[model samples]
Target: MKLRELRIEKGITHKQLSDDIGVPVRTISRWEKGESDMLLKNAIKLAEYFEVTLDEFINF
Candidate 1:
């Protein structure tokens, strides 16, 4: 996923993102590591948080 790249480009840590988006840090980490899948709602939240379209967010 492009999640880690986007988060780094935005200069925010996982904890910061989790706090801002109300997701847990471990969940963010798991998502980044590809160890877990994100729900559509969380994905939408992330897309909105990063100011990207859902397509852009999901596209590699």
Candidate 2:
């Protein structure tokens, strides 16, 4: 699933996700929109927060 899809499925907003992962809200928005690449550190954080794997975030 895309980032947006996963986030919505989890019932969380972009700002909430940013807070969970310590990234800026804009960056999370960009990631969801495919406007920017996810950095490794941020990806790991996101994966952990969402209880997913890094590959799931990148490739699912």
Candidate 3:
């Protein structure tokens, strides 16, 4: 997933993202690390947060 890349590009820490999006920091970490799958709702939230389409968020 492009989670880590996008987060870095946006210059935001995982904690900052978690606080803004109401996700747990660990969950964000897991998603970034490919250790777990994000729920669709959470994925949508992230896509919206990053201002990207879902396909770009997940695959680009």
Which one is best on lDDT? 1
Question: Which pairs of residues have clashing backbones in candidate 3?
Answer: none
Error of 1 at 40 (Å): 0.2
Q: Candidate 2, overall lDDT?
A: 0.82
Stretches of candidate 3 above 4 Å error?
none
Tens-digit lDDT string for candidate 3 (1-60): 689999999999999999999989999999888899989998889999999999888786
lDDT of 2 by residue, 25-50 (tens): 99888887878987788778877878
Q: On residues 1-60, what C-alpha lDDT tens digit does candidate 1 reach at each position?
A: 589999999999999999999988999999999999999999999999999999999995
Question: Could you list the CA RMSD of all candidates, in the order they appear?
Answer: 0.7, 1.3, 0.7
Q: Rate the local accuracy (lDDT) of all candidates.
A: 0.94, 0.82, 0.91
Candidate 1: misplaced stretches above 4 Å? none
Q: Cα deviation in Å at residue 3, candidate 2?
A: 0.8
Which pairs in model 2 have colliding backbones?
A: 1-60
Q: In TM-score terms, which candidate is top?
A: 1
